[model samples]
Target: MRKTEKIFEVKDFPYPHVIVKDFLDESTLDLVIDALAGLEYDFKESDLFSYWASIELTDIDHPAINILRDDLGDEVWRKKVAKAFGSKSLSSIDMAAYVYGLGDFLLPHDDQVEERIIAYSLHLTPEITEEMGGSLQIFDVDNNNSKLIDSIIPEYNSLIMFEVSKHSWHQVGEILQDIQRLTVTGWYHG
Candidate 1:
């Protein structure tokens, strides 16, 4: 179950972002992860990204996915997330599970799409290491020059969220080892 009193601390610099650790209780997270593992994913690739992703979670007919979608779409949860980012509304959300195996990566780009106010990634991997190389990289761009500023390891059960803007540049680093960087990600729309 989602925590009712969970506090969202929005941070400035490199664009507005927030990271909530252990967003889901241990048992609930484990169940969600197990449910995700049971779903089928299709390999998707392009110049910008490469990974295996499932269909939208909302459209899935599974118990865990339904629970996750319902919780994320809850009025209280939506309001809390929206208020944290100073957003007017999180009336809708789009979610999907992603699996990044060895050699998979996503190039840098801001998630600027129609009405997407907040972008989020919920990491579900049981374990990870620096050498595995599936880290989320945040970039800083000034005067048309881009520089890598931060590389965040995919810590288990952590949820990362950021406001989608022209400057919210980020990417998923290539997976170097035999590890699956699994995450449920999407956007909260206004």
Candidate 2:
């Protein structure tokens, strides 16, 4: 397991965000991926949106869930995130693992739920390319027009965090390949 000191922020976009590389060691990453592979996923799809599969991380006793929760909830880690994103103290973490295969997509929406301060995604997908179409698209909103400002490709052992606000409109692009786009994503609430 690698420590959390290497995390860094990226402020050159629609909103301030943090990107942490090498979030976990090779062995731990493999363990987490294996655990997720064994868990059953609920297919979430609708005309309004599409989510291929998801498994909530509500089982605190599960080893992979425990590891992620512990790291995200750690005081040091929280403080670093808070300072980097200019947010208040984060009080709670709610998360789930998502697997997006071919045709899976999520429409643009701001994650402005009450009490939620920050949103994060720990990318677990490997060998993803720009053409694969499972990118996190951040939008810039102006006069009811939302334009694409950035698109982040999901990379293995990388974490992306952003402030949750009305202008924080984003989407997960449709998957075009047979590969799975895996991510452990959720919000930090105040």
Candidate 3:
């Protein structure tokens, strides 16, 4: 089924989250990905904590990016997200495009901030597999003793959104293959 016809699947394991496959139509997804590929990205590496290529979308003027930001900021989508995560104050959206190549990884961290209520990632990598190794790993928050709870593979046109709190600790596993693990990630501020 198309994303328009499918309801978001709610999952409550290590935390409350939702996953939506085929989040955008093929044409739109293609446009977004193409736009992302054309942008200049900066390599970011922070010792053992994080490493990736990223491009901020705040000042970009591309049509596809604009459309995506508008959709994400729309009241309808925000309402759906708010209801799904049981939050009534999801208000603003901030985003950036990321590319995780070989050896790139993000360490476990909770996305808790004063205003951030929801965190989301829209995967745009094509033909990714488990062997590629750039998966989103969620952990059971146990202070300094967190344990792995789940690992979600990066699937093309798939979206994952979760409530941002002290317990929402997660990480991106290192990419073992020489391929791009691209995604649009952001947070909805309360």
Evaluation by TM-score, superior candidate among 1 and 3? 1
Indicate the residue-level lDDT of 1 in model 3: 15
Q: What TM-score, computed on C-alpha atoms, does each candidate reach?
A: 0.95, 0.93, 0.93
Candidate 3's residue-wise lDDT over 1-190, tens digit each?
1245344667887888877888887877778888888888887878655455556686778898888887666677887788877787677798998888888899888888889888999899889999999899999977688889889997888888888888899999999999988999999988
Candidate 2 off by > 4 Å: none
Give the Å shift of residue 154 in candidate 2: 0.9
How does each model score on lDDT?
Answer: 0.87, 0.82, 0.82
Q: Is candidate 2 or candidate 3 better by lDDT?
A: 3
State in Å the error of residue 89, model 2.
0.3
Q: Model 3 — TM-score against the truth?
A: 0.93
Best by lDDT: 1
lDDT of model 1 at residue 23? Answer: 78
C-alpha-based local distance difference test score of model 2: 0.82
